[model samples]
Target: MLNLFKKKEKFILPVSGDCIPMEKVNDPVFSQKMMGDGFAIIPSDKTIYSPFSGEVSVLFPTKHAIGIKSDAGVEVLIHVGIDTVSLKGEGFESFVQQGDKIAQGDKLIDVDFDLIKQKGFDPVVVIIFTNNSIKIEEKLHHGEHHEKLSISIK
Candidate 1:
């Protein structure tokens, strides 16, 4: 079948932390995989990087989430924290603008997790497929950085 030749896209942990299954996320929208199947990270640092080469399709006005369309046409949404959007951009700084071309590891945003916590929010970074239906073929090792989380279309 033509599907046999489909190229797999590999993404890395966009933040430094333990990679966890989407089901482990504290949010229903993500834990239930309502937004789409992917992974989550309990980030230990403030910086978030691009998971793959792509064009930033949407950067929420609150600077809490960003969506990127990969070169292979995969749309990824990276949400910074749980309920942090209610902060209205406080404690969040975006490095790239919408429509900007980004490479893997490029800094996307800097967040003040302490502020998020002080504001009573969970600073869990959530990544999900926004436009296409794809399956995570492989997950990175726990605590691994700069390693790929391979994915393929169904």
Candidate 2:
């Protein structure tokens, strides 16, 4: 019966990138985990994918960020880069429309790191679990992109 009450499941990385601890993020809002408890990705690839199977909740007009509402009821926010909204949609592309159902790893957007760098923006993607009561199954990330990111929801 205790096993039935256990929280256990995994959430995969949306894109291939270096996973950085939320503390390493330069922004206080993210570094402090104000958004939610999750890590950031210093992208090794320019493409952004859905981290969870969900409907696209928010896709910024500037293409710098996206919010997803998982079928499981978890809300995920993927913010691409720091202070990048100022770029004004210069180096990003969106593949899915708002309300589109997405499976894990589905391509959502593409980014031009070269352009972002030239314009002085750090393209570190922040993945935040928006709900306040979220409890993670695993608490350690060492910058490795796994086939699946094991996480459990309580």
Candidate 3:
């Protein structure tokens, strides 16, 4: 099949916002577990944007998570925080619904960072590939409070 010759694809951050590395969670003081694949440290409270160009594949009923399918066939899952999905959409708003076409930096979800923290949850956004078998190259920018994170294929 022609599929065999297709080049490996890459996915980049959907938005221009803060990013944190997951390795920092090893400290007990943070008391957080890396639930998924990628790590991001968000320093401010604002809108969460789409990291890649794709259709809104899945929007959690709780409004705490979103899934997007990139044009290159990469599925991206962005969870706002650990267990924040349990909030059931409280203090959260969904800007895009399933089947909606979206491009990088498009507003997808607006989360109440204060309310998230008030609820005793950390607002570390996580971007992960739902299909792990796909080859990916992750690019992480170091330092605290950084904007403009990048990712690509191998």
Candidate 4:
């Protein structure tokens, strides 16, 4: 019952990649609305790697979303694109399954940008924490498409 009073913890990025911010959250429409919570956007034609070291908490059957738990007890959720979940695994592929252990840089999923575009969805990737009580520290914006971005515990 005391869990409600637990102090929020901040989580750092698990991988070093470009961070893209979604226009909105929990909205099925692809309209570029304002984003509520900040999200890290990773843009790459290659494989999407695990940002933090943790066990896979959830893997959407559509291969559009994944959830991971960090060793530090932080929970993270990654969604590939807007409204892409409805594709039902068309242009997306999962390399790991639920309950799998993953480390930073570990390959998690492979996304086909071309196919995703063909399906009429933008391949804007988002990395977010499922738990939001934690405070973030030293968050840095290393510029779009920059490969040197780093995230650290606050």
Q: lDDT per residue, candidate 1, 28-140, as tens digits?
A: 99989988877788888999988778899999999999999878787889999998878999999999999999998899999999999998998989888777666666654
Instruction: Candidate 4: count the clashes.
Output: 8
Clashes of each: 0, 2, 6, 8
Model 1, residue pairs in steric clash: none
Give the TM-score comparing model 1 with the true structure, all chains together.
0.86
Per-residue lDDT, model 4, residue 114, is 79
Q: lDDT at 118 for candidate 3?
A: 96
Task: Give, for candidate 3, the lowest lDDT window spanning 10 residues.
Answer: 1-10
Q: How many clashes show up in model 1? A: 0
lDDT of 2: 0.78
Tell me how far the alpha carbon of residue 8 in candidate 1 is from the true structure, in angstroms, after superposition. Answer: 3.8
Candidate 3 lDDT tens digits, 1-154:
0021143443445444566555554333232432344555564656787766789999999988898887877676787776787788887888889999988678888888789889888767666655543222344455554443334322
Candidate 2 C-alpha lDDT tens digits along 73-144: 778899999999998988999998888999977999999988998888887988887873454444546666
**By the lDDT metric, which is better: model 3 or model 4?**
3
In model 4, how large is the Cα lDDT of residue 109?
A: 85
Which digits, one per residue and each the tens of the lDDT, describe model 4 over residues 54-108?
A: 7999999998888888777767677787788778898887889999987767889
On the 0 to 100 scale, the lDDT of residue 50 in model 2 is: 80
Q: Rank by lDDT, descending? A: 1, 2, 3, 4
Q: Which of the two candidates, 1 or 4, achieves a greater lDDT against the reference? A: 1
Candidate 4 overall lDDT versus native: 0.62
List where candidate 2 sits over 4 angstroms from the true fold: 1-10, 135-147
